[model samples]
Target: MLITDRHGRILIQRVDYRTTCLLPGGAVDADESPAQCAARELQEELGVTTTVDRGLAVDWVSADCLNAPASMRFPGEILHVYDGGTWDDEQIAAIRLPDREITSVEFVEPARLPGLMAPGDARRALSALRARINAAGPALLENGLPIAPTVLDRALRTARARHHLPFHVGPVPEQLSVVQVWGWLLAPDGRVLVLLEPDTGAALLPGGTPEPPDRGDPFITLRREVCEEAAAEFGEPLFLGHLCEPDNPYARLRYAAPLTRLGPPPVDPATGRTHIRILATPEQALELFDWGLPATDQLTAVHQARARLGIPRAARQPLTELPDATDLTTM
Candidate 1:
């Protein structure tokens, strides 16, 4: 129990047979620490406030139950008292006790404390409280231990390492291509194009031929297929190249379009250049059936590219990344 008043006056509660009043305190509970117990009781007893700075006093009372006041030595049980503060008389008078164990109370001034309380272990509490007051500003820790610098480096490092890894989307294996092709992009609006497969017959786009490793040419086969199928003498297929193989389906549908078909001629008569079929408006060409190849996605990709590469259709087998006009290179 602790006793303190607002204006530096000490509270003494009369309990047991002590001639004078003693500071109010109680036994620590079974599972509570001494500091915590002290604070709890101090608040419960004195209606006044209490705070524990380091532990103020520690004493042992043995065979307290003996009536003969036998001089038994203290073995284990220890009592911890705190040098809480003092209050003014008015504040002291306001302090009340839990009626069960306390009989009366009193306020004692430091100069006249000796005569008011029994001169036993209780007197020691007064001396301790005074020493605490003399120490000045900084208060003590609840358990008398000093707080020091602590490092959390390893913990921080562990957290960062675990949290920084990229989220795995899924598995994708790289694929090598074995063919290269080209198509005749027709339509004044660029909405229709042409392709072809050897056995399946003439596709609107003319392209298809097994490619040799690094054949050093994409139009290599485009010329052959165009002449064989359309006999249309193209000056080397201005090389708009390959579609996906339908195998390498891109994660987000590789919509990278390298499509560049010939544009309409200028109205200037002397602007001498051969007429070409780059922009084929839907109104001019018949709506041929969409590419009906086994690779539906690849056909879809080619379809999308013909229609302004609407969305990046995923890479599909039979459809491969196309080569630029300069990339005479083959798969």
Candidate 2:
């Protein structure tokens, strides 16, 4: 089974009736472990021309397998899955699986995995795997990722190694600013509470400062920023402080967003990524604040945000800091 991220479709090959259309893997040779076997089979079938990325997990499929045996085909299989730690999708796709025994291969979105997988335990395996990945990340397995029973701090250990990119404790940027945005939330009395133009010359909140991912929390930055901004602008909160990042900035996305960004645009300095998304809502801003919302000519990023407010502060900080959400509630 060659792994790919074709939008979301995972391509699979049904090699034979015994195995069905499954992730690329096969029976281990004498003295070979399942991991060695899967890697070998994927390369053998998909062809080693493509690199296997980091290992995702081992799925246990002997119990619910629908294939007829050799009696039940495989009574159970410990599937060692690797995402193929793909770097470039284009490069991966270019690799051809010329082995002729492969009957058919095609892309199927992960969401469509349940329907494509043969029924019985495989369906359960597919469903459970999807749920676990959605919740705990794709690295955990059906039997659990840490089943090895290794000796370590039970609280600290995870199945993940240094291979994956999305989360790296030392991998995260050390210092980052928490930007507190305050926009007009219409009051029942019709008093539009907004930062004074004379104060900020813009409707954005006054607080923007760097904080550690580990220590002098970003929440502290947010609260301290709000107070300073409020004092400078004589802006009083109609409902108090609100904070937002590009996509929760600190968390995973909650919903699917449809974006048609065709661009040769600016890079986000904070993320150091080319895909720049600079947006906020009074509802989103107000989901943490309150009100209908305020229109643009209102938001700014990092250092420039502070500079525009006339609040003297530097946006730079060491990456060791972690955001303290309590700072806003503490006041």
TM-score of each prediction: 0.33, 0.38
Question: Deviation in angstroms for 240 in model 1?
Answer: 99
Error of 1 at 158 (Å): 64
1-331 in candidate 1: lDDT tens per residue?
A: 4454432345677775555666777778889988787778777776555667665555443445222434443343455667665455566566667766677776544334556655444344544443343232222222221122111100111111111112112232345343435454332223333322222221234444534542635445554444443333333222222334344542211111333332232221222322222112221111122222222344444454545533222221111111112111121
> Which one is best on TM-score?
2
Which tens-of-lDDT digit does each residue in 147-211 have in candidate 2? Answer: 33211111111111111112111222324333332223222211122222222112232335444
Q: Per-candidate RMSD vs. true structure?
A: 36.2, 18.1
* Residue 87's lDDT in candidate 1: 54
- What is the alpha-carbon lDDT of model 1 when measured against the actual structure? 0.39
